[model samples]
Target: MTEPVDEGLVIYWRPLCGFCQRLLEALEVAGIQATLRNIWDDPEAATFVRSVNDGAETVPTVVVDGIVYTNPPPDQLVIHLQQA
Candidate 1:
């Protein structure tokens, strides 16, 4: 029997957020595959994002499995995901 592998990280952000754009660009440069969820398009996602950060609608919030990162920088996020 094989253990189930995690499906990588999920990033919740908005298209117009500069920080989100930076994070995306960095992820692209690092060749990382992250599930990008735009909160603006999905109300549930927006609500979820807010829930993760005490009702703060901060973009570039990423969830690695259940671990939440509220607006973490690109490099920091890279290291964090790698360790996960």
Candidate 2:
């Protein structure tokens, strides 16, 4: 909700999204630094999520180095982070 990121990892989420919470927790445990964008709070963020999800507002959408991932598994996200 603060600012959108252009590099590294950006996690688009909503506060009430369970999957988002889970992913955030996983990132924390993995010591991954990611910019968090709350889609519910930012209309542009929601639109971005929709664009990447076939026009559906899917929370926990992750972007790394401009690459978008829709609801990636926690372990897979970690792997992506490592690759980033």
**Which candidate tops TM-score?**
2
| TM-score between candidate 1 and the true structure | 0.84
Give the alpha carbon lDDT tens digit for every residue of 13-57 in model 1: 897899999999988988889887788898878888777778888
Query: Which digits, one per residue and each the tens of the lDDT, describe model 2 over residues 1-84?
Result: 323469678999998889998999999999998888888888889888887788898878998887788888998889867876
Q: Candidate 2 at residue 8, lDDT?
A: 73
Residue 59, candidate 1: Cα error in Å is 0.9
Kindly provide the TM-score of model 2 when superposed on the true structure, using C-alpha atoms: 0.88
